[model samples]
Target: MQFANQTGGNDFTLQGLLNSADTSVPLFFAFLCIFLVTISGNVIILTVVTMDRSLQTPMYFFLSNLSFLEIWYTMTIVPKLLANLIIKSNNISFSGCMAQLFFFVTFGATECYLLLVMAYDRYLAICKPLYYSSLMDTSTCLQLVAGSWVTGVLTGLIPVLFISHLNFCASRHVNHFYCDIPPLLELSCSNIYLTEISIFILSLVVLFSCLLLTLVSYVFIVNSILQIKSNSSRNRTFSTCGAHLTVVLIYYGTMIFMYVRPHSSYSSDLKKFISVFYTVVTPGLNPIIYSLRNKEVKMSVKKIAHRVLPSGFKKTQKNVKSIF
Candidate 1:
């Protein structure tokens, strides 16, 4: 496949996923469905969490933040991905590419920290139930959310700073779907030793550190659950944490494999496959996972659906009558 011109000094061409005519149509529609579902599902999660009085606890508050982040996180990449599928010679300006990279990394790191916070939240709730409310009060929850965002922004910014300054005299055709760090680094003509080391160190420090802490929190959580006398209560306590742990495992597993490895180990096909999982598949699946597993969220969703469907049907009926 012929790539875009290298003549445009500030533009990099992306060899997007499944550019073949036979697969493009099906892939585009599939991703469109996923994108729509991802957006609508997360929106429902946000609305339900906000409206449900019973879900006003610290756990649901963090969940709402997660839903909010998922919306923007999916938004950052999916639209461009859809466009790239249709528009074969997908070229992005240097600034636009950098912006996309920044937001993607920022959201990614924010998710890591947020998951850590959620794990810690569970730790407190299960291991120290008596002090849970006082320790994770409204003020403290807001501060934790704010800190995660701030930390993500800074983490994303530093990598972009290093990347933007690098000389891109090599070919401008990136062999991946979006502006990921690995592909962009591969395209750079400059000395990338420093850039690679810095990013690798950051990824290790940020991703693994969070992973380690989350594991420790879960260790304590499991121990606390085991100590409970009643089997039903023990199962109930473990149930509350099941969804978060599932999400954490899926998200962290894909991300660590993608970002933490050496540059020489990069495989274009493997990278693309992994990217689709975290970026498209995970976002679409997250709300479903959380809502399906949590009884309260299901009840809240049913309440919202009941409240919305009638009004929507009425509007459709009125429009039909006016047309007639």
Candidate 2:
């Protein structure tokens, strides 16, 4: 529970964001702000989608799920990073490291599958408008979301099982901000050829496979857009898909680069830099990207702002009148 610096026989030390004392305070505040904003943005999305009945469709449904995922996904890593930065200690126990690794992979793989499902939902709506309702009904959406979470849990478990059992005699210090596969593998004294191969294949399946399917869905989506006669309609459709596409490209691009390669080829500095993207930057950007680019979301947000702002202003005005 405590982010201690002392390492025992099985404990490993994480090399947090930076080593310089000068940067620690600034970095802590910076990360704290990012964490707060990310949480607030995602929470607002969840609130808007849940409260606004008009926004309760398949698209918003998946989006709410994504917001939920982003919340915990960031929670799994950012809090620890914040702790490490402020505490000025990077030590994590063997069990603690494995737990972190497990949850990180779970949320990560879940995001991959969830993104795929979101793409598929868009595909159904755009490509098969008439059948979209019947095809992606409430039950179907729930099943897809549930499956994504379950699949992510299973995907995360495998690598953790293998890596946890590995002998970490070479070094007790991990070279990155968190307990990641490549850094852990680098520390192992045992033969890690099999472990690396297993991770590579899993990445191919979870990360690359989902990405390929998402791209294919977009292919169909693009074709559907081109066939539409109204320029405005076409632009509207593009705007809808554009936000999801942007998220897909950024999430998958960073993920594939981070996971799909051989562990031996990983550069410590590069790994840390890229880790910041998926871990902090992408999650922070998701709600903003979706809300700003999405008309329905924007409208709902406006409605909420209208209701809440007026009530608060009225209360403030009453307080000012009483003071006078």
Candidate 3:
């Protein structure tokens, strides 16, 4: 159903990554590959973590949560994007747009909180090793995960609910691949001062606050690592935290630049590229970044492969021998 726009309609058209017919097929295949990798990688992480008793620690638990989140996070936008590319019609109903905005924001914010929780987990593990198990018990881990989801939902709801009521009498064409806060605000004909202010405040509170907490945790972590007299211990500690730090830099760098700025400052083309980076590229890279560099994850994957492959190979050999 169409909502009222400038021309008195509810349907909004998304201006996807590229509009040329020549590029559509290539873009579709490219994104399809990325999407598949994103899903499969995350699924592998989840499966490995769940199956292996060795991966049942606080660290792997959070890594599994992140992998699970990335699956949904990528799902929210990439399918529609793939559809838009093939069909060449970017029209999304008002309800669909709002729904997309809701889930996208929810997952993104939830990730921020989850990353912070992970940082704290690492801090406890490194800085206060003796009490790590006691402090980050099963109950605490569950609560932190629960809190991140709840906070993400609540935070995401505020902007969408507010934006949904605004009059989009200016235009129905959104200049990005997805329904994001800045693009939606740009479409509003109504006075957006209060809305912008609210969003800015929320950004500072939600995004910056979590970033600050993560930084503080890392500070303590670094200090603890420096205190270790053994070079091997120091190297080991750096290796463990390095993956998370790499992810943090990439995710936060794009996100903060996109969301924390004034709506007027948005350059549609630049924002679109940045949006693609965070939404599409980052999700696919997360599992690789976290797993390829991680010895534990690599070990877990090898163990699972051995467990599953050898039995299947034996059965196949038995069938071949019987046939011969």
Candidate 4:
């Protein structure tokens, strides 16, 4: 589409970056700091999972994968986003936009599935203690992780492939920090009915299926907790699942609010704000949330510290000593 009064590339002129309303130097610096922490936090979790022998269990295995996913998830958006916030021009090409969407979809799907697996694991441990070891064995764990990745990659790519084929000559500006499906849909120059239906169905299946599984798992877990005769054991059991529940609540709450609602509720600003919690904040905090609140992870950290600091770093070392 040529320019109206001017020359070529008028209607299809490449777009540029859009930053926060107060995209000042201070805000830029603040976001930069947040990004750094996100990276550093996930990295620390990854390192702990890798080096700490006590953390070689299925739970830690999932956590390690999660840390890795968060790293890649943030990397997909933060660099270009930060650059766009600071620079005068923040234009991402069509190919670049599609690539970002692809990755975002993948990581999003992976998180959904991983959380389901975590919930199921929790259920097994709490409700079926005798079967936990046999159920979440190495082969089973490997299959779940592998299936999460595969499903995420496929679902993420399918919509991207279908949507990108639509002509986007009308407008190129995306109002959010990165290229997302909803924002991208707003730019389509072709019929999006089929695409919308397909994505809607896919989203429902993935989100609802996982939500149902998690809910059922928690129900069983709660029942088991109630059955415990000892208050101390009950509290200890609750503590083990508390962090996972918190993370799940924050994640599903934001996601359901964002994507699972009607289009009438759609606001790019609101979407961007909500997106921060799940995409940015959640990843950054998951490691700390788990390790800080978890006895096992805390114990693992202590073991690592004590073992690494000198020799004979007994497991009895205080968690406070491991935080450093």
lDDT per residue for candidate 2 within 217-268, as digits (tens), equals 9999999999999999999878767877887898889888888887446667
Query: How do the predictions measure up, each by TM-score?
Result: 0.89, 0.89, 0.90, 0.86
Q: Which 10 residues in a row give candidate 4 its minimum summed lDDT?
A: 2-11
lDDT of candidate model 4 versus the reference: 0.75
Better of 2 and 4 by lDDT: 2
| Candidate 1 per-residue C-alpha lDDT over 210-308 given as tens digits, one digit per residue, 9 for 90 to 100 | 999999999999999899999999888677667668778888899989888766566688789888999999888877776545778776666665576
lDDT of each: 0.85, 0.85, 0.85, 0.75
Using lDDT as the measure, what is the rank order of every candidate, best first? Answer: 3, 1, 2, 4
Q: Please, what are the lDDT tens digits per residue for candidate 3 over residues 1-324? A: 233553344688999986678988998999999999899888988998999999899988998999999999999999999998998779988888999999998999999999999999989998888999999999999999999999999988999888987888536889788888888887888888899989888887888899889989998998988899999989987876776687787888888888786555656788888888889999988888776557687667667766778767656545433422
Winner on TM-score (1 vs 2): 2
Task: Kindly report which residue pairs in candidate 2 clash with one another.
Answer: none
**Model 4: per-residue Cα lDDT over 214-286, one tens digit each:** 9889888988898999999888878767767888888888877766643646656677888878777787677
Off by over 4 Å in 4: 1-23, 306-324
